[model samples]
Target: MLDGILAARPRGFSLAARYVAFALLASTLNLLVQMAVMGLYHGPWALLLAMAAGTAAGLAPKFLLDKYWIFYDRAPGRLRGLRQFILYGLLSVVTTLLFWAFEITFHWLGDGGPLRYVGAALGLGLGYWAKYHLDRHMVFGRA
Candidate 1:
């Protein structure tokens, strides 16, 4: 039964599965970075700083994994990779804003602590999901 289920997986399921796996890794890294920063600092700016730090920390690894693994975008040149990275950054700006809004709103609502981390996780999850489609269609393009 399990083998039948695995065999019946859709054409792009493997790619999506890999993407989700890598995204989870990146998201976890992002949350850890945010939590670490929050632990050391407390203030309005600290929240912003932590968000930015977490985002930056997760960006490069996510980009590499998406480019080389998920999208299979090996175009054989630095320029292509750079252009893709720029597009990724641009798309990420939109998702980052979405993440920040949710995170900030939840943080204020929860009054900080575990709830704040919960907010961050929720925000990051939503952002990464949206980003996968955007990255697939816009940044990396279909394989």
Candidate 2:
């Protein structure tokens, strides 16, 4: 039954699977870093600072993996790579807004407990999935 399910995946499923796997790993790291920052800091802006740090920490590896492994984009020029990174950063702003909305909403609803993390997880998952499509067509223009 497991073999049958595995065999029935459509084309590009493996690529998508790998992308999601890497995203999960990166997100986990991001969340850990964010939580650690939050723990050490004590101020009104702590969450914002932590979020920024977490996002920055995870972005580099995610970009590299998405560029080389998922999109297979090899343009062979630092200028082109910089252009791609700029585009990715633009898209990231949109996704980060989505993530922040959910996270802040949850925090407002609940007093910064597990619900906030739940919101962050949901937001990041949705953001990354949307980001994959955007990156595929807009940034990489592969598929």
Candidate 3:
């Protein structure tokens, strides 16, 4: 059963896993920067700004990784890399809006430092899902 389940899973999931890891690392770095330099903590505006920055930060590495490693297609005139970037940028905005919405909702929920971080995590995860699927198929696929 376990082997069957594993076999049934899409290979894109593995690629997505790597993409998520890299994005998380970038996001974490961005978050730390916002916290240390900007001194933002547990506020809706602060979280939104931090996440926006983090999303932008994540895009660079994510693009490189997805192009060279994850999708790994080598066609001289494909132009998918550049197209992927633009699509990903648009999707990133959607993700950012979703994250901001969640952050605002969480802020309305209550005041707890740890919970705020959890809210951030939730938002990041949501964005990651969209990015992974879109990158795997739309951005990288030949079809």
Q: Per-candidate RMSD vs. true structure?
A: 6.5, 6.6, 7.9
| TM-score: model 2 vs. ground truth | 0.88
Clashes of 1: 0
Question: Model 2: which residue pairs collide?
Answer: none
**lDDT of each residue in 1-143, candidate 2, tens digit only:** 64353334346568868888989998999899999999899798998998898888988888877887788776789999899999998998899889888888887778977788888888999999889989998899995
TM-score for all predictions? 0.85, 0.88, 0.69
Which one is best on TM-score? 2
Superior by TM-score: candidate 1 or candidate 3: 1
lDDT of 3 by residue, 65-127 (tens): 556656665545646557767886786677777766766577667673546556667877787
lDDT on C-alpha atoms for all candidate structures: 0.83, 0.85, 0.64
Please write out the lDDT profile of model 1 over residues 1-143, one tens digit for every residue: 64353334246568768777888899899989988998899977998898899999999888887777777665778898899999999999999998888888888998865677777778878998899899889987784
Give candidate 1's root-mean-square deviation (CA, Å).
6.5
Each candidate: how many clashes?
Answer: 0, 0, 0
What TM-score, to 2 decimals, does candidate 1 have? 0.85
Give the lDDT of residue 68 in candidate 1: 70
The positional error of residue 50 in candidate 3, measured at the CA in angstroms, is: 2.8
Instruction: Using TM-score as the measure, name the better of candidate 2 and candidate 3.
Output: 2
